[model samples]
Target: MESLIAAVREQDEAARFLVWPGDFDLDRGDHVEEVHLASGATLEGFAGDGAGGTYFFCGEGGEERPILYADSEGGAAPVAIGLPELLRLLLVVPWWRDCQAFTAEESRELAAEYLEDMPDLPARRDRAAAALGIDLPAQADVLARLREVAVRMGEDFVLVLTPEGHPYEPLFTN
Candidate 1:
């Protein structure tokens, strides 16, 4: 994880793409509000997005732990089983946040918008992936796995507010 982060930080274009399209900023690991897991597992905030959304590594361990994404609006979801999987999602389908329906057509439509804005998205993503030593999956496959992680495996890892003791709503739905 440290090496991958260093590689990303070393590259200007890869860092820019991750910050813009991927919505991932390693420097912003702190969460705005107090949060925890309903299961009482350790939730470590390791990254954040532009909209105050945090990516937490669930449970104790290393970067191999499951990752849960919690939005400022009190919504959360298990986005990936590990850091590598999460990076693949970000590098392959940076438009995952815009994919509400989680379908191929929706991905294509959203991908078009990104491609129009950055024609070298694929090439840039490839370079980023290569730097991280990760082989990304297809867009549809990544999205599908994302949904599966968020909706299925996500059931066991729920996010909750610490002070209010209120649980966050699920970000993904069947």
Candidate 2:
């Protein structure tokens, strides 16, 4: 956990976006006790929240840790495993969300434009890919793969949280 936190802190892009609760002195035992009391589950680690949801690590020690997503409404669901895998999933979420509203070509163009706007995107991409044990491809290839993952994971998997509501209700319910 310390290594993961250190890595996230070293990356400028990650440090700007990933909000680890411990970084804010909110990962104390009292906080975990409160969570356990409120919900029957224990909090292994507080990863971060974005797009109107919080990501957390939950599992007993000596077991495989699963990453869980808690929506703004207090609903929770498992999303991925470990911090590195969760970070990888997060990197492609925007691309997945954009694909829903745009055509393939438009999505690709938009992804490229978005990456172009982020000066440190390449480094971030490299970090995420290395963590996930996957290769980061060109913009077009990335868009294609994002679409493929969305299709494979289903519509509910690529939920987009809007200001008015949480789109992850269906995911949580199931």
Candidate 3:
């Protein structure tokens, strides 16, 4: 298991210390719904007319998925409607690191850094091709395929593609 997963599984103290500020609406976008906790505690997050806040969830891989939502009358701690809905909620949010999940702001920052560090998407693609010792044309083709994969599976899961239109298998044998 990845170290992050291990840390969460062990229930590290840091896990509890992390907090995402948001109004957790348990209603699944409904007008009237009841929200409670495992311990049956009545939970209210952000309350009042025209209030705004955020709620946080732990992702399947132990990453924090923080989401911000607002309601005219405020919100409450999100109740798990079901397994699938809970899973969907997990995908819509970003992976948290340390005390906070990557907010929309953070994603922009990271994307900017990545673009600045590379400065050339096509060149980076070419270099990736060269690192795999593939020809330029084949590399371009594979990159196109990867781009498609990135579009389709983005956030739902992580994917890596090869020049042959196959998923890139990490080098784990060495």
Candidate 4:
């Protein structure tokens, strides 16, 4: 299969949509700080958000490797096990950063705000998903999976500040 990064580069609308609501840019893969995984696994900066946040592929592998998100604020979490899952989260819930609670009610409120800003979020997301050949799951499912991945599956994938030898704080609390 062709790499999702390659696909994103080739698909204009997919890349555009990801840039807008997703706040994701393939060109901004550079993380601002020096960091490493506690397990000493290979951490590759693959993508980034508008802020100085980085999306890293943990361990040695292709896009199938676990993904860790580290924000400039020094918080980190394992958002997804793979690139596909991470993209699904971005596509379904662009306001994921605002969703500290990660509840259906909170998501609904954030969705409403986003809808007000970009009423065509669903259509745009659908086109992006189609372009990327990704089958997006329901918003609830995506959020639930995010919670599980960041909260449950994240303990083993701790991000450490290489400079100070201190572990980054967990982004997701519940």
Q: Predictions ranked by lDDT, top down?
A: 4, 1, 2, 3
Scored by lDDT, model 2 comes in at: 0.45
Question: What is the number of backbone collisions in each predicted candidate, taken in the order shown?
Answer: 0, 0, 5, 0
For model 1, the superposed segments whose C-alpha errors exceed 4 Å read 1-3
**Which 10 consecutive residues of model 1 have the lowest summed lDDT?**
1-10
lDDT score, candidate 1: 0.88
TM-score of 4: 0.98
Candidate 2 weakest lDDT stretch, 10 residues: 25-34
Candidate 4: give the clashing pairs. Answer: none
The prediction achieving the highest TM-score against the true structure is 4
Summing lDDT over every window of 10 consecutive residues in candidate 3, give the lowest-scoring window: 14-23
lDDT tens per residue, model 1, 1-174: 375667778887777778878999998899999988989999999889999999999998888899999988999999999888998899888888778888989999998998999998888888877767788788889989998898898779988888999989999877
Reference-based lDDT, each prediction: 0.88, 0.45, 0.29, 0.92
Q: How high a TM-score does candidate 2 get?
A: 0.48
List the candidate 2 regions with Cα displacement exceeding 4 Å: 17-39, 50-52, 62-64, 94-113, 116-120, 127-174
The residue-by-residue lDDT of candidate 3 on 1-174, one tens digit each, is 243334322432222211111112232333232322233222333221113332323232223332222233322222222222322222222121110222356444644654565465345434433432334433223223333323332333211121333222211111
